[model samples]
Target: MQQQTGIQTNPVAALGRSTISFVNSLGDIFLFFLEGVRLIFSSPKQLTKIIRQMYFIGSKSLFVISLIGIFTGMVLGLQGYYTLVKFGSEGLLGAAVSLTLIRELGPVLTAIMITGRAGSSMAAEIGVMRISDQIDALDVMDINPMAYLVSPRIAASILCFPLLTALFDVIGILGGYLTGVTMLGINSGVYFYRIDTSVVMADVAGGFVKALVFGIIVSTISCYQGFNTHKRTDSVGPESVSNSTTAAVVLSCVLTLVSDYVITSFLL
Candidate 1:
């Protein structure tokens, strides 16, 4: 009876332990994000690193962002045209496409794309460094790895996300113009006029705000996952790195979408 009792697991204890661990993880991630963001302004030397990351996370992503934006806008134009045509309001396609792009799809899609491309890279790179002891080496040499590694990425993301979202919005609008005006016989002047009349500064601001939030979420989650790769319970070394990278991308995207809804509700 004593041995059986000793070997038995307590469900309540297990649940409590799991809850505690989850809370501790949340606290750790929050602190990690604070430190990373705080260090972004620690020195002017970080400018170089920030610029490099911007190139990787922003400039390199332009083609894909533009491609996706155009197709999304084209599809929106098509759907909006058909839907509004039923009521003789097909001319409003431009307003529909522009508003949709600027208010929602633009920022969300841009963030998701960057998360897939750069967020995964960030996690994998840092995870590899952690497993290989490179991060520890930096620590032993008195280097602040979070500053050296994470802060610049976060800064770059903050700077790049809004810009990318803006680009996507513009390209998407042009795509709508191509479909609605060129292909579907929408009056060019009417198309642009509707867009100019329908969109306001508040709509634009809200999209940028969402982009900013997504940037912070993606960069922080990616870095946190990678930074703690060695602590993963399920795997070690390369497998752990891979797992972290997957988690980073998945979590970043999920959070970006969830935050989008929250931000939209507040903005509205």
Candidate 2:
């Protein structure tokens, strides 16, 4: 007779534990978003803070976003041109590049870039504040941490992500133009006409919606991680921030991909 496996887990217990964890995570994010919204509505001078946050998130991220957008479009142009040339349809490269960027690549890559740039930084900043008891200090002063600390960040993310995505799309299309038309001799008329006729307001709107959703997820996850960071000694502070930043980036990416599918299904 075969021996049973050691360390067997109870199926019911495992399922129960997963279900509880999922529910807890869901509730936490809901509360976090709700509190942030409540604070935004109640804040008298929140516009100033939101504006500063926007500059930080939007302006600071602009260069990297632009750089990546152009390169990505050029790469798509090259690959797409070669692929379509096999079928003597190289003129359609612009349409291929535009559709790919607006429908999928733009929002996804922009979110990931923001996650790498600002999301990690946001998490670390919050984590540092938490570890140093700065959050508690705010509490002592009768300030709502959600308003002062979280609201501006979350709002800024929501506002900036779509705009960034839009810029990425435009720059990428231009890059494709540079590579496809200028380099490969694709007719400007055909390229522009195809892109114009093929890409509609609905495509851009769908990309915008994805960007907005990704922004909400990234900001909320990063802030939540920071708000709950564990206290550490001076030597371990860096380690704590590093861990929180990593967690924030990883969670942001995973959620972005998953939500992309969900949103795409509905949009389609």
Candidate 3:
């Protein structure tokens, strides 16, 4: 009877353990953020390292970002022109394209592109280092891993995201110009005039702010996943890396949209 009772309760016990583990993971993330904040203020000498990271993640990512931006803008112009012309407001195409790129598409698309390019590489590298105990070695040598490993990434993301978004905005606008004037036979002068007149400084500023925040979210989440990597007894570090990458992408995308809405509301 006792043996039978034990067997019947095993699943319930497993469920309870799983719940506890999930709660513990949440706690770990909160603590990680706290530690990150502390280290960010305490360590000023890591700026150089952060700049290097920005060069790799942001500067090196320009080509892919430009490609994505150009295509996205071209598509926007093509689709927007058809819809606007249906309403006899084809002249609004330039404003529509610029607003879309500046207010929504620019920051979000650039962030997604960066996440695919840099976020995965960051997670994989850090996870592998964690599994190999190199992080432990740094700790032993009196290096704060949060400062040396994580803070630079956070700083880099904060700086790079805005710059990348700006680049995306330019490339996207140029693509829109090509599509609207060359392909769609829209007046180039009117298109440029509408875009230049309708887009305010506030629109551009807001997009850059969103990019900056998105960068922080992506880098922080990816670093957290990487820093906490543990080699599964049956699995490998690649699994952790992959999971981290997915988390970074999802969280960054969500946060970007959420922040965009909030900022737009406040500005309006």
Candidate 4:
């Protein structure tokens, strides 16, 4: 009966277990995040480590972010022009593209891109260190692995994401301009004018807020996943690293989207 019960679990009991597991996971991640933050402000600052992380994360990510932004803007311009032209409101394309990108796509897509580009790498790096006992070596040296490993990453993400988002917005706007003005013959003056009038500081502020929050979430979740990987059971060489990396990327993206919706609901 006990063996059969394992196979045919009670729905209520299963749900309760799942709920508890999820809450516990959240608490673990949250506690880890706080420790990272606290370590950032504690004594013996790791300025060099932090700077290196920033360069690796922010500078390395620029090309991809720009590329994605350009193509995305072009697509938006093409589609938005078609939809607005049908209603004879094609001039509003500037406002539409600007609002869509600045208010939503700019931050969300940039974070997702970073999650793919950097977050996975971070998780894999830490997972590898953990597997190799290098984290233990740091502990033996009396180094706070969380500070050395996690805090710098969190700080880097917080620094990089907003800048990447800003760059994305700029490049995306230019791409939209190329499609709308050069190809479709939108009045350049009217396009810029509409964007200027329609996109206020509030829109920019909201995008930055989203970017900052997304950055923190991605960094912390990725690091936490890497830190918590079970070396003894899960370490199948690179499989463990790759698995943790994949989990980090997936969780970062899900959290970004959910948070985006929640932020938008409250802000807009």
Candidate 5:
């Protein structure tokens, strides 16, 4: 009878345990982020580290961001023109494209791209360090690994995400101009006019806010995953590093999208 009861409740028990584990993980990640942020201000010499990280996370990512932004804008211009033409509203294409890019796509796409590029690199680098005991060596040298590694990344991401998002918005606007004005015969003046009139400071501000939030999410999650590579249950050693990198990228992208929606709701 006891065995029968235990079997019947096993699935329920497993579900409860999983739920608890997930909640605990959330708590841990939050705490980890707090510690990293606190450590960012712990030392005055951190500016050099932050700058190096900025070059890697921001400058190195510029070309790819520009390429993606232009293509995305061009696609929007083409689709928006076709859709609006049906309603005799093709002239509004400029406003549509600009608003869509500024309010939504620009921030979200930039964050996702950076997650794939810099965030993955961050995870892999840290994960390798963990597997190789480089992080432990830092500890032995009396270095605070969190400050030396995680804090600089968080600082760089915070500074870079907004700048990158702004660049993306501008390039995307140009791409739309190429498609709409040069290709589809939209009046160059009307395109500029609509964009100027339609995009307000609020729209731009909201996009930046989203970028900032996404930066925090991506940097923290990637660093956390890498910092704890050895704790991954399904793999060990180098295999764990790979797994952590994959998980960091996937999770950062997901969280960026989720947070996008949440921020949009609040901003709206």
Candidate 6:
């Protein structure tokens, strides 16, 4: 005798599951951004917290960023000089360095640095709080977690990133100068002149805008990942920190690049 087995399935089940997942993800992202905006306008009461975070995220990370920026600029100048020399256009080296650093590289690199330095820490700290019920403790005490935790970090990012980018821009330009004039023997006056002429307020403005947007993205994503650490307290271990960091870095990079294209297209 052959036994017949019944196959049980719902045709729309997969579709419904996908739809709900998508909607939930969208809602999470929306709320993340909304919380950021809400914190932006809340008050000045969190100034002390914001300043401390700025010191951690911006001031403490300066040495690393400056070192990276210098090397990046030097390499860019050397490569650009050689490439431009092929066409007897080595004089354009300054313009190349300034344009690349200010328009694209500076903001993006600073953001990446901050992500590795601060974003991971932010996520891990908040994730631990969530797992340990510290966040719930705040709720039980009538303290607003959004105001106390997320707001200060968001504010700090907004204030810190642009400043860091500007610092990177200056350090990068100096490195390019050293490479162009000292290593390549390009005339100092010509180098500065070309850079001055090539770079404008619009370029600086666009880059700062990119930095600000990236800051917001990084803060929101990291905080959201941390805040959502509910079900799996044990699972919110070291691996969760790594996952959150990876997500923040990847998302920040994608958003920065995409926003760059959009901003440049609109501005130009």
Considering every candidate listed, which one attains the maximal lDDT? 5
RMSD of 2: 3.5
Q: How high is the lDDT of residue 126 in model 3? A: 86
Ranking by TM-score: 5, 4, 1, 2, 6, 3
- Top of the candidates by TM-score: 5
- Candidate 1 has a TM-score of 0.94
Candidate 5, backbone clash total? 0
Q: lDDT for each of the candidates?
A: 0.94, 0.91, 0.83, 0.91, 0.96, 0.83
- Candidate 6: Cα lDDT at 73: 90
Model 6 vs. true fold: TM? 0.88
* Cα deviation of 97, candidate 4, in Å: 0.9
Determine the C-alpha RMSD for candidate 3 after optimal superposition of all C-alphas. Answer: 3.5
TM-score-superior candidate, 2 or 4 = 4
Off by over 4 Å in 3: 1-31, 41-44, 231-237
Error of 3 at 53 (Å): 0.4
Better lDDT candidate (4, 6): 4
Cα lDDT of model 2 by residue, 88-189, tens digit: 999898899999999999999999999999998899999889878899999999988889989999999999999999999999999999999999999999
**For residues 1-268, what per-residue lDDT tens digits would candidate 1 score against the true structure?**
8866754676777788889998998799889999998999899999999999999999999999999999998999988999999999998998999999999999999999999889999999999999999999999999899999999999999999999999999999999988898899999999999999999999999999999999999999999999999999999879999999999999899888899999999999
Question: Which residue pairs collide in model 3, if any?
Answer: none
Write one digit per residue (lDDT tens) for candidate 4, span 64-98: 99999999999999999999999999999899899
Output the better candidate (1/4) by lDDT.
1
Give candidate 1 regions above 4 Å deviation: 1-19
Q: How well does model 2 score by local distance difference test?
A: 0.91
The CA-based lDDT of model 3 is what? 0.83
Q: What is the C-alpha RMSD of each candidate to the true structure, in Å?
A: 2.1, 3.5, 3.5, 1.7, 1.4, 3.7
